[model samples]
Target: MSIFLIFALSKINYARTLIYIFHLATIPAIFAGAALTATSIGITGKVLAEIGKLSAKEGQIIIGAAVLDDILGIIVLAVVASLVKTGEVQISKVIYLVISSSAFVVGAILIGRFLSPFYVQLVNSMKTRGQLLLVSLIFAFILAYIAQVIQLEAILGSFAAGLVLAETEKRSELAEQVFPIADLFVPIFFVCVGAKTDLSVLNPAIPSNREGLVLAAFLIVVAILGKVVTGLAVFSKEKLNRLAIGVGMIPRGEVGLVFAGVGAASGALSPATDAAIIMMVISTTFIAPPLLRLVFKEPTGSPQSVSSEQ
Candidate 1:
């Protein structure tokens, strides 16, 4: 979603002309950002770690919003890539990507509607939870591969599989059974994200020149503003604080960084540029909690605030 904005602003030779004019800069910026995204145990760790403290209401809705952002990020990258590659603004590809994505969404709904109940029965019948692990992992991988084979994003495939499984009778059990794997591999993903960022450059001890700070400031604005608008995506007045909900959903985490990584490796961005984008991510994530908390007021009918004994 932000990438679409970036691509658009870059076209105007305005906001991000720094990025477009020096294609070299975008190279490393993209990878470093990706490494931070896919590799960093980012906001995922934060969200997971916050389990139980927030309402069950909090966990489910927050996670759903994040997943929405994740899916949107993937679509943004695919659409941008198509635009760049074809040079024709192929309306056909835009249609295809949307149709394909919708198909995945529809397919997942069907799985939940039909296939998941069968899975519920199967999981229920298991003697030990171990077999569910094997079966689920295999299923997820197969679906992911199928998505890739179909010229769709693998994460989309995997996410679709997860979403379907999420709505099943045994959603809680399934998440619990596989958390071991999620814990191990997931952190590496986050750390790898951190690994890509050489913060040393930002240190006053090194590349910490005034210019770097100035540039970092600019990037911060870009990053923060980029996601702030996404809050508008929420039009609901029920349950959660819409602004907080939107703020909570702002962290770019894995997918944004992954796009940066791809762009860099493919010579789309330079190292310094990649670092700038990473800074943007950091600012946005860092800003999320405070902003969210600021906007947080227990909604009408909220479990705690409105119902509390005054």
Candidate 2:
């Protein structure tokens, strides 16, 4: 993190002023939409439910943050495509991206917010076969394909599809059916991420070739801090512990893997960069469950906590 760099230099107590000035000037140089893309799927809500902790107060907060993080990512990625073709600065991109992102957001919002619910309601109103499962998969794939057509990630489309399913009256039935399928493929995504590493890149043997390392370090920081900041959105002055909620949302699961895979596919990521990215993903995922479990644990004799504790 350049933010951390400022602090690190502060510890040396030498010419910090110049460093801060340069840093301040350069921050405005970042690509806003690209910078805003989050680390990826936090332990999505279904994970918490399977662990039997969804009802806990803290679990609810974690799930809320994770959901918000996903929402922020969708908006960010939609905007990122617009900003890229026209490499404007962050401030300018903000305006252009908002307008660009709107159509995608509105379209998704219509499906997620209105159509999916109505469809589920209509389906529930029927006594037909359980082909709702097939219908949903078709919808997910169609949206995924559309996301690709728009120069966005298929995962983003899938997530939007997920949100629609989440809001539907068939949420329970749909979740029960789809989660088993997600469970099967999702871990493959993660394991593949771990598999793609070229350890030689992460090696410090060629310290002279430092550019890849620099980019890796910068991107990892963005990946973590961006999502963490968004996770804090789950709280206000009167509600959940914002820090805990944010921390719980820190783990980047399938989302990060998909990002790395995409970057590699795009030829934008080098071998060393891929290794570094995989390491970052592993760290976040390893830390998340334990941190969440700790923070979400309630004091003794609490029935709600007991019932929800995994």
TM-score of each: 0.66, 0.67
Candidate 2: segments with Cα more than 4 A from true spot: 1-58, 78-98, 111-113, 121-130, 208-235, 293-310
Looking at model 2, residue 228 earns an lDDT score of: 55
lDDT of 1 by residue, 1-310 (tens): 4433433333234223444533324323323323222212246336434432245454445565555445555554544443334444456876787677768767766866787767767766878748777767777888778777766656666777777777776678778977888889878976886787665555555553544555567656545444445444444555545454445656665566666554544445445555666676666667765564445543433455423323
What TM-score quantifies how close candidate 1 is to the native fold?
0.66
Q: Which parts of model 1 are misplaced by more than 4 Å? A: 1-64, 78-91, 123-129, 198-216, 226-246, 262-267, 297-310
lDDT of every model, 2 decimals:
0.55, 0.56
Instruction: Name the best candidate (by TM-score).
Output: 2
Q: Which ten residues in a row have the lowest lDDT in candidate 2?
A: 24-33
Q: Count the backbone clashes (under 3 Å) in each candidate.
A: 25, 0
lDDT of candidate 2 at residue 130, scale 0 to 100: 64
What does the lDDT come to for candidate 1?
0.55
**Of the candidates shown, which would achieve the greatest lDDT relative to the real structure?**
2
**lDDT of the structure predicted as candidate 2:** 0.56
